[model samples]
Target: MGKIVGAAIVSHHPGLMQCEEFRRAMGAGEDSDLIAGYSRLRAKIEAAKPDVVMILDSHWFTTGYHLVDGGARYTGTYVSDEMPWYLHGVPYDYRGHPELALAVEAVSRERGGYNRAICHPGLERQYATLNLIKHLRLELSDTPVVSVSSCQNCEWQHFLASGDAIGEAIRRSGLRVILLASGALSHKFNGIDWKPNHPRLFHESNVSSIENIQSDKGAIALMADGDHQQVLERWQDEYRQLPWEAFGAHYLQMVGAMGGRECRAKGEPLSAYENARGTGNIHIWFQP
Candidate 1:
């Protein structure tokens, strides 16, 4: 049977990729400390040597249906429509896993969560996805990847169900998988381009997020026990998480698919300023 050997919730706040001056100003140094957390995840991935890396990014959005990149290869230069200056002309080259994408589609459909499988001769990578591939150095890993869209306009519950379907598919496919959810905690942004070490924009910043993660030892602890409803209630009450675009929805799929297992974090976090915008960035990881 296929198994989820590794899973991570990483931040992709653009600055983690496109903002070097901002990082230097804030003392993030040459290598972004926030993205440094991905190294541990990378190590776990290397050890497990997963067959496919399945990433569900908020930016992989579709208007009407949950979609998968079912293409055979994804190669192109990426530029963010939102912020072109920071993320311009990003070259990306990666292989796609059409089989796994189709499997996810079948599973979602079987579970009554409709999905779309889209393939093209050549497909472009979204900004968030490009950041992940570059930061994690996934292009060098030789593992095929499948990206899923957190469908636009779908109810939050739809994402939850889709996550369940994904987990089910992974467990049964007999293909090792690594799941990554790219997002941030509190996604409100600051209008001004604040300098480095700018304080978080929201009242409930990384402290609140870490405390919540600590209480459960990671959100997956609560979610793994099928207490996802309780998890949703707590998140709503404690943190009015506004996903950066499709951010919250992206993570909802990860949390829903956790299957009641804890992904204990390792070592100290590589926390950094989320961006010039008022958000918090914490680099967290779990052992395989």
Candidate 2:
């Protein structure tokens, strides 16, 4: 087995828009700290010099229930009857990868249904991450990178599986591996009324939460016991301490996945900053 030489968990905030180097490469203006976060993240990966890097972002893929066939067999989630139709049929075919149509067709046959349920919004996020990876590959010399959006169902399982796959792939390539979980602390979107005037309030609260979780002493403690409500309540209580506008829990799942990794290293406290669109940057990292 290949050794995990380095690991990191970072927020994909738009702060990358500010970096002159990133702007020239991506030909885009910096809008939020999330973008800047990704830019800095890519730099960090290059510096780490890992043979392979695995990036996990919550925004990249949607959660769906469906199966896809890869010539020999069908593979998909069976949680809900909802199938991942968005990935079913596509116009373009990528060589060596599953054909969209075949995969969808196989899923239809196995699931006995044409009612394709899709996680469209989730796929869009995945596409964004893909776009970032493409840019990174193009800008940095050919890095032989592979990307995969975590499955929608039981994200933790998918996270673990992805890590395992990366470990195996690295061993085959005979290179050290680095894992990066790209996400945020707490951020509220969707026009929610909760907006704290000071970014520090949100940042401090989230950092505290993460610290608590890492130490096995916070709301996440309840989460481990399947006490979801209590977990939410605890998070809500933390939110209450901060200004109202801070909201976004999906990012928390990413952190939870990092904490679960057996070979994972300790996480460090992250700083926060505001960007062009008022989106706060919650910078975090975990190393192994």
Candidate 3:
């Protein structure tokens, strides 16, 4: 199997597209920031020479557990003014990558009673990123690409299974390296009536919660006790303390799930661009 060499967690906030201040700092053109980040991120993957790259997003699937089909299927749910679509049937090109699609279908079939519902209707940026990745895969010959959405139905285990599948596929394909996982850290909404200057807000506090959980001493323990409320409360306490620069927690959780692999190297923060509206990018890297 190809070894995982690098990983990163990034937030795909929509405001990134409008943040011109960030563009100038990153020396980027007028294209979308999501596209730029993906380009830079893909460059890192190519430099690492990994066999596979996996991108995880928190806002993809619905919360439901039902076995549908198996093998490589492009099943997704979309909510946009341009195309409002929900795909429940098998993909037309099931024969292209039948095994992986079969695995997903089997899991969906076995996990019945899955609550498949959309939580938000405005997360078009995620769908845009998904399309961008697909386009990149078609244009680039250096790496085999796989993408999965972690909508409500997906748990940590599901993500782990997907990673395992990618590893297995790469081994079978005779690739020597894999670049797995991309996401971000704690992200509190701006609508909560909280100020960045509040004493409770900062990166250290956010990192503490993540470190605590990763160390197996934080809310995960409470979650184990089935005390989701307590876990939520504890997280809320931490979230209330976060500063503007550290608003990437939701993305971080997805990255942490794909742990146990070494990063190639870590990059310095490229830029810290903030706007009058209080959203920006923290461009850093973890090369495996």
| Highest-scoring model, TM-score | 1
Model 2 alpha-carbon drift over 4 Å, by segment: 14-43, 62-138, 190-196, 199-261, 269-281
TM-score, predicted candidate 2 vs. hidden true structure: 0.47
**Candidate 1 vs 2: which has more lDDT:** 1
Q: Which numbered prediction scores highest in lDDT against the true structure?
A: 1
State, as a TM-score between 0 and 1, how close model 3 is to the true structure: 0.47
Q: What would the per-residue lDDT of candidate 1 be over residues 192-257, giving only the tens digit for each residue? A: 543433243212233223443343344445434445556576655444344334747776777566
Look at candidate 3 and tell me the lDDT of residue 226. Answer: 35
Per-residue lDDT over 1-288 for candidate 3, one digit per residue giving the tens place of the 0 to 100 score: 345565544444443333456544433333334445656766665677654444444444434431112223233443444334331221111112334334434433454423122222222234423443443452245343444454344543344444444434434444444333333333333444544442222222233333332422332233234343443344434532442222222333222323412211433332232221233333344543
What would the per-residue lDDT of candidate 2 be over residues 1-288, giving only the tens digit for each residue? 455565554444433423455444333332334454555656666777765444444454434522211222212221211223322221211111123323333434453433122322222223323334443452244343323343455333333333343344344445555555554333433233444443433233333233332322343234334443443345545632331111232333333333333333444433333322232234444454
lDDT of 1 at 53: 85
TM-scores, each model vs. reference: 0.80, 0.47, 0.47
Superposing all C-alpha atoms, what RMSD in Å does each candidate have to the true structure? 4.5, 11.2, 10.3
In model 1, where do residues sit more than 4 Å from their true spots?
A: 19-22, 28-31, 193-230, 238-247, 260-276, 286-288
Lowest lDDT 10-residue stretch of candidate 3: 87-96
Regions more than 4 Å wrong, model 3: 15-39, 65-128, 131-143, 151-184, 192-283
lDDT for position 103 in model 3: 41
Once all C-alphas are superposed, what RMSD does model 2 give against the true structure? 11.2
Ranking by lDDT: 1, 2, 3
